[model samples]
Target: MSKILIVGAHGQTARIVIDRIISETDDSLVLFLRNSSRLNEYDNNSRVELIDGDVLNTDSLVSAMKNVDIVYSNVGGTDLAKQTASILEAMTKSNKKRLIFISSLGAYHEVPGKFGEWNEQAIAAYLPGFRESAKLIENSNTEYTMIRPAWMSNKDEIDYETTQKGEPFKGTEVSRKSIADFVMELLSDPTQHIDESIGLNKPNTDGDKPEWI
Candidate 1:
């Protein structure tokens, strides 16, 4: 069975992915999180292993990556650049090539119009971190798929559409469950999205265009 490691295990999106994996796949999962206390909320399962490690702690992260086939990261914060740097360093040192990263729609600095303005205003507090982290992943040698989702809601539904690098997909918010579904889909066939980035959004929703046009 494939060994998968998920960073930010306590996040809502992460939890959705975890539940999907537990119910649909036999692959083993290693959950990396800063806090071990929250793990108890999840049902005990033999397929799950919880590791207490912050993404910023390179040593711990590297150790946890041992024998891991895939790394799915849902980490987010104002210090995203540093955290992503640490994850990259750890994955490189471990010789792990598969990565599925969750980024924000604002990472593309050139999308024009009011939607861009809205994105800028929404992420202005953390734009630097998002931009730099995305650049690091883009330039890295690892096989990676960076998924940028529009505004996220904690809704239970898992309906959404994805747009590849060439398409424009931004505007309405998508549910965290949908993002989790996308990650699970990628995990089922990791190579399908290698060396690519994509945007996700709810269907038929119209609003300000994405800033990352």
Candidate 2:
């Protein structure tokens, strides 16, 4: 019966998480996306309410957050920090505490070896924003869990492991389904990683970079 708000509803990772939520729980969901037309696929889902709005607009974010119990942010890109700022402001105004955010693994420059070097070079422009967004959540009063996932793949499996914020990040290439499963686990028990940032990766993989990459 919990009401959860999902921003960046059209994202691949968000879709996976939403599917898992719909299939496993009775929780009502509010999906926030910039374009309402993109919600046609979910028209028959009674448990989902689609809200059209930009995360950069605080008023729109606040409106979407109304009566929302938990907020799941899957937004990325260079504007991520700005969007996160708006989300934090709206959540504070609405008195919503719980947040689950998706970030990238090398955002902290924690990934080591060749893959780490490659990731840094590849996303050099995006990492700073991700890092800033993480700091924003860390300093906020709300209960937040930031999930920094390793290189992702379309692999059809849900096998992954996690590393704490300060721990050295390990492994590479976790499936989107695995990340979704982890999010589902957190949704089932919100108290699991309160105010903690975690890095996720596929287990037992030993390589500098993901094979596919």
- At residue 90, candidate 1 shows an lDDT of 96
lDDT of 1 by residue, 1-213 (tens): 699999998888998888889889899999999876698655377788889887899999999999999999989989999999999999999999999999987687643467767778878978888889889998998899999888888777988987777566555678898888889889998878899888888887557853233
Candidate 2, residue 43: the lDDT equals 82
Top lDDT model: 2
Per-candidate clashes come to 1, 0
Worst 10 contiguous positions by lDDT, candidate 2:
204-213
Q: Model 2: per-residue lDDT, tens digit, 81-198?
A: 9989999999998889999999989767788888788888878899989999988999999999999998889889999999988787898789999999999999999888999899
How do the predictions measure up, each by TM-score? Answer: 0.92, 0.97
Model 2 misplaced regions, further than 4 Å: none
Give candidate 2's TM-score: 0.97
In model 2, the Cα lDDT at residue 213 comes to 62
